[model samples]
Target: MILTVTLNTALDITYRTAALIPHTTHRVTEVVERPGGKGLNVARVLSALGHETVVTGFAGGRTGDVLRELLGAGATARPADGRHGRRGRPRPVDALLPISGSTRRTIAVVDTATGDTTQLNEPGPTVSAAEWTAFLSCYDRLVPGAEAVALCGSLPPGIHVGAYAELIRRARAAGVPVLLDTSGEPLRRGVAARPDLVKPNADELALLTGSRDPLRAAHDTRRRGAHAVIASLGPDGILAATPDGLWRAAPPAPARGNPTGAGDSAVAGILSGLVERLPWPTRLSRAVALSTATVLSPVAGEFDATAYEELLPRIRVTEHPAP
Candidate 1:
């Protein structure tokens, strides 16, 4: 099973309006809520793709209860393809450790007229020392059975900055490949742990390496420690630096819709491909396609399956020789 760790799990709430005008009252057209956090989003996408996934992290209080309820119930509606929770395929296993502090909530407001998304995120609840220790115990048990482990998202308040780094080391010791998706100091330290892969967007990449150039920043990041770095360039696509080779992959065209969970979808794509033992180029293609499809999907954490299939072959993947 693929294990995903979301230290700060959340209830993702999305609101849709005809148009978003500053300081003006508007009627809400739609509202959708689901379990969220970087890792939870990845687990959902992985489950949708027919992979056995296990999610573990902090979940407590009322919001945590609702989040876990949704996860347990599975997807509200099954897709036509019947991949997610269909034919007895496993849904994401909930192994979340409860905490005293309440889980956080994230809001995404979509302007349907302009196809823009504005996000409001609350800093997740503070984790206690005891909670952290409990989680580590759970993680230790989960790591041995996991084919891969994803240490994702922000560290909730009260957790040390080096948390991801510690997790990376533990996963590495177990010989399980790990993918880290986080930013700021946690990212700086986690990269130094030499995770199997690191996925950072352009701004995060620039901040981490102090370089705006994608290739230069990616190379610098790898030098700091990651075995491979796949930098997300938003609509421009992805730039990857790995021991096997370097490559750039992009969708045939920019997709228009909510892009809330696009990066997590990309993480899911790469992890799934890695477990399946696909080549770098193929994995990158899947990542880009899934990312773009997530952008086209109306719901957060959901990808347009049809668009993904159509865009896979058309994605442009050009290899670059190591400098």
Candidate 2:
């Protein structure tokens, strides 16, 4: 089982335009609304893959109600565990646990001309000190049931930068393996608590480690106290560094479709492996497959089962010994 904490959940909105131009109206060809927040996206995929997933974090207001409603409406929206190699069927998940504050929303304008995207994210709700204290109480209730915990996405207003540090400490005490995915100061401070895993995209890794190269950035990121680091490199796939060693996951085939939430999906793949206690190499492959699946999907932070199945066998992993 995996427990996912999305401090700032959102209702993801995607718009399709022939060409994304600044300050111009364009006809949208498609739109998708789902429970977002990085952890929620991972949870959605994990549930489809049959992992037991519980989600906690901040939510309130009508938007929060809508977010939970949307999530509860989606069948098997389980939290990501990173190991999605199960043979049979994934378990179903459609339960909604209440919390305070309405979730935020993320908008993506995808340009049909270049298949590129322009993303706009809400800063999220204000989490008063009392709200933060309340969230921890919810976490306390949920963390005990999970085999691993994934703390993902951005922080809302009123959330102290050190909040993740506190959550990491609690997870450590609970003996639940943790995977954290966020950026900026939250990512910076969260690592000091030594979570089990941190999955950052190339840009976030660069900002966190000040390295242009993803691999080097991942190497340095490990020094921040995370037990392991997995850097998602888009078409470059996932580069991972842990106490075990260093490994690179490269897809043998070209990736097709839009690239959105592939990182969160990859996080799910990684956690799934942790749940299965599979080797790191296998975890890397699963991450690659799940991420690739996300790109193939028309929606952000979503996965295409057919694409994932096809891509899993094609991902290649090369291992290097740790210094």
Kindly report which residue pairs in candidate 1 clash with one another.
none
Clashes of 2: 21
In candidate 1 the C-alpha lDDT for residue 158 amounts to 95
Question: Model 1 off-target regions past 4 Å?
Answer: 21-26, 76-87
lDDT of 1 by residue, 1-323 (tens): 99999999999888889777889998989788789899999998898789999999999899999999998988443456653334666699999999999999998888988767788998899999999999999999999999999999999999999999999999999999999999999999999999999999999999999999999999999999999999999999999999999999999988877777899999999999999999999999999999999898755668888888989999999999889
Worst 10 residues of 2 by lDDT: 75-84
Q: Scored by Cα lDDT, where does model 2 land?
A: 0.80
For each candidate in turn, the TM-score is 0.95, 0.89
What overall lDDT goes with each candidate model?
Answer: 0.92, 0.80
Q: What RMSD, rounded to one decimal, does every model reach?
A: 1.9, 4.1
